[model samples]
Target: MNEIAVGAHAPDFTLTTDSGDVLSLAACRGRKLVLYFYPKAGTSGCTVEAHDFNRLKADFDAAETRVVGISPDPDKALAKFRLKQGLTFDLAGDETHAMLEAYGVWGEKSMYGHKYMGVERTTVLIDRDGKIARIWPKVKVAGHADEVLAAAQAL
Candidate 1:
């Protein structure tokens, strides 16, 4: 079960990004952070979600917010996906799933009759103080960025 909740202090983590740079939860402090978790990158749904976030990046920036996408993909795969999609924001790799578990996005998932462990599609909106302001669980890709942008703008 996802333990993270609104009004709670978001779990801290350090991850490797597609650009071979390090990103830490602490680094996002003092800024509105939109931390999004996806099952995988380059897949249809994930790609759409990434593109949607990338598309609204300017708006997010205007709202003084930063977006970070995290998945269990390795750094090399994340690099390829980031390059392929022309994503400007940080795409982090969680190969160990430690950060994903700390954020409660990693768990067992079932698809069609088969069960497997994977990342759940979720988004946590963090306030400038690093507390969770909102959360979107089991996200629907279509128009998701608009919804997130509205919330971020409100914050």
Candidate 2:
């Protein structure tokens, strides 16, 4: 697992968004960015996380930050989730899991005695200078967006 540390320069990446566009670390330069990684799309937990981020859209915007979600799902699934949830931010599919691995969110996971590889529900806050400002590993969905917003605002 490629673990990233806060204060380290964020590894740059470009991912294809649900809208057929793209979200790149370089594009978000000079502004804060929140990149949340989830195991799957359209699941209950993932939906709640997306909604939390969506609900705080205005607050995030006011904080001069951009929020983007990353997952291993295909673009089709991501598009559906974004539309169904009416999410204002971008959702990018990392089917290749390259970016996910670079951020160290993809790793061994198990449920009901079955071990497999998947995303670890991580969120990374990248500051304007492209350094990692904060990282939430094994994130709990409740109040997560609010917490991230507060951090972004502080930056």
Best by lDDT: 2
Q: List the lowest-lDDT window of 10 residues for candidate 2.
A: 79-88
Residues 64-135 of candidate 2 have per-residue lDDT tens digits of 999999999999999998998899899999988899999999999999999999999999999999999999
Per-residue lDDT over 1-155 for candidate 1, one digit per residue giving the tens place of the 0 to 100 score: 45898999999899888998889979888889999999998899999999999999999999999999999999899999999999999999999998889888899999999999998899999999989999998898999989999999999
Whole-structure CA lDDT of model 1: 0.93
User: What TM-score, over all chains together, does every model reach?
Assistant: 0.97, 0.98
Error of 1 at 6 (Å): 0.6
What local lDDT score does residue 99 receive in model 1, on the 0 to 100 scale?
84
Displacement of residue 32 (Cα, Å) in model 1 is 0.4
Query: What are the clash counts of all predictions, listed in order?
Result: 0, 0
On the 0 to 100 scale, the lDDT of residue 10 in model 2 is: 100
